[model samples]
Target chain A: MQQLPREESLRLLGSVPLGRLVFTQNALPAIRPVNHVLDGENIVVRLNDGATLTSIAPPAGEAGLVVAYEADAIDPHTRLGWSVIVTGYARLVADPSQVARYEELLRPWVAQTMNGVLRIQPDLVTGFRLVAQPAVAVCAAGGEGR
Target chain B: MQQLPREESLRLLGSVPLGRLVFTQNALPAIRPVNHVLDGENIVVRLNDGATLTSIAPPAGEAGLVVAYEADAIDPHTRLGWSVIVTGYARLVADPSQVARYEELLRPWVAQTMNGVLRIQPDLVTGFRLVAQPAVAVCAAGGEGR
Candidate 1:
């Protein structure tokens, strides 16, 4: 596995339209696959008003909601892929103009009208690329390839 | 989208051997794609001794590691699939017998020898199926399907 630089990580993140958003509900973790659009440095996602993520999001003034956003593209056959993880503070985008802009740019996947626009301001970014090791490298490292 | 029952969720989980495990490192969220095996009710994963997960895991006797395991299969063309999330407590399997048992049963994806065996005991399981809404159903509901 090779660690990716921050810029490369963010680029890879933007390459995928679908990803998983992870947060805690009642002190237990919960995750949902969400469609997202990258806007500069922020990750923009739409959540329904009644969705758990929207309900659990911290108020604008409060310490923003800390969540994990992850996206990846891995070939099931070759098992080669790159994954990116972003840990950020999420808050509702209350500005009407911004909300309208996002609505036009990002089409929600579900049937419900996504009235809640949440932006994740990432503080930590990390990623890794999974590459198959050659037999020579494995032997050089004193191990047998599986 | 339809909410899946517990049995269906577990069955879907068992069908896939790959998933993402989410945890916290330095108060920030982290995620890694890992290969796992369903052992009765526990989700077993192998991590190298120097891996981030093994280093951050809570030691024995303390409250087990709180983590989230998520897996899914979605078609890129249709954007339809099932996603499963399991909120669980992870603990290292110190029993040599169990470790050996798992090593033989589960093949690690990487070349490294997975020295750490972590078992996640799930406390909550939830999943959802994303099915494309038929045009008729959308029209009946007074909306247009995307």
Candidate 2:
């Protein structure tokens, strides 16, 4: 698997129509399927009253989070796919101007009604792809087919 | 989605056997599908010389991970199955006694060699399920295609 740069990584993330947004709070991990669009430099997400927004926006010290957005190839037997992840300090943009910008730039393709918060200002991001290797390669541990 | 307890959540994770093991190091995110099992309250994972292990065992301060495991029905439109998740901190256990116990408790069910570092500690676990609902409710999203 080849490593992709920041720009290409953002591109790949935006290209996928849907991804599972993973985050943690109080050491408890949570994930949800979301439709997000990549907006310059940051992986901006529009959150309703779902898991993404609430689980991450707890009190300040309690807000440590790791958000992973991934989309994989359609095949399972042959696990061929790529993913980009951003792990950083995610903060709710209560600031009016930033909120307005996110609303204007990134739009959720579909799903959810109320726009409660936006995760902006990601600290780091990277991309990876599992080559189109034989199904055996995908299993890494050999395809015991768990 | 049905809310389940600690034991059931671990069971669902063990049952799937394949999923994205997400973690971060130096704020960079990484994911890898590991053939894993549930040994009581711990997430029993067999590691190779891979990025996943490297990321999971990053300097203690920089360590955080979210294991995204799922056992969902193939057809979203059917809404006939459920998916569960377990999120928590992971540690590298070179403890021989614990490793041997896991070896007996979980036989590698996949086609992979069962030799490597094993992660067996968890801080949190949570799960969700989609009960068997009929067509009308399934299509409520209008996107869950049968």
Candidate 3:
């Protein structure tokens, strides 16, 4: 495995539309799979009124809620791909025009009504890529060096 | 989207070997991608010494650490698949014989020394499946007579 640079990591993160959102629920960790759109360095997602996340997300002017977002694309058979994790503060979008723009940009995966928009300003971005073993190293380990 | 039964959820979870582990770090949520094996109702994963998870996992004979495990198989194109989330307590496997058994059963995906093993006893198992709209519903919405 190899570490990915911040720029490369963000690029990979933007390539995927779906990711898991992690937060503290009842003083314990909770995860929910959600669809997101990368807006520059910030990640934006839509939530419904029924979602607990919507209630927990900090409102416009208040301090943002700390959360983690993770996404990856690994082949089930090959197990070779990249994974990215972004830790940041999430806040509810209060601007009506901005919310309209995000609505035009991101389409929720589910059919439920999504009235809440969240913007996460990432503080740390980390990623890793899984690669196959080098053939030369494998050959050396097998004592079949060329 | 449809809610999945507990049995079905576990079945889908076991079908995938890779999942994201969610835990708390410095009072903020953190996530990591790891390979796991489902042993009955419990989930087992291997971690290297450098992994903070190993340090946080409760030792044997102590109360388990609260964490969440999530696994899914969703197609990027169609965006249709099942996702499973298991929130529970995690504990380090202290039994040498059990550790050896897990080591033989689950081969670590990364080429790293995985000296620690964690077992999570799920307290809550929830899952959802994203299914295509039924033909009848689509026809009704489109006002096209079939």
Clashes of each: 0, 5, 0
**Each model's RMSD to truth, in Å?**
4.2, 7.0, 4.3
**Candidate 3 residue-wise lDDT, B1-146, digit = tens:** 89999999998999888998889987889888888899999999887653576678878789889999999987666667889999999999989999999986667667677888999898899999987665424432444324
Candidate 3 RMSD to the real structure: 4.3
In candidate 2, stretches whose alpha carbon ends up further than 4 angstroms from where it belongs are: A22-24, A27-33, A48-74, A93-115, A121-123, A134-146, B22-33, B48-83, B87-89, B95-116, B131-146
lDDT of 2 by residue, B33-86 (tens): 455676667676666554546545642344534444433222333433445555
Go through the candidates in order and give each one's C-alpha lDDT: 0.78, 0.55, 0.84
Off by over 4 Å in 3: A49-51, A134-146, B49-51, B134-146
Model 2, CA-based lDDT: 0.55
**Model 3: colliding residue pairs:** none
Clashing pairs in 2: A141-B112, A142-B111, A143-B111, A144-B110, A144-B111
Indicate whether candidate 1 or candidate 3 has the larger TM-score. 3
**Residue lDDT tens for model 1, A29-87:** 66778888999989998886446666778646668889999999886555678889888
Judging by TM-score against the true structure, name the best candidate: 3
Q: What is the lDDT, from 0 to 100, of the residue B17 in candidate 1?
A: 76
B54 Cα displacement, candidate 2 (Å): 6.8
lDDT of 3 by residue, A12-105 (tens): 9999889988999889998888888999999998876536766788787898899999989987666779999999899999899999999767
Candidate 3 lDDT score at position A78: 65
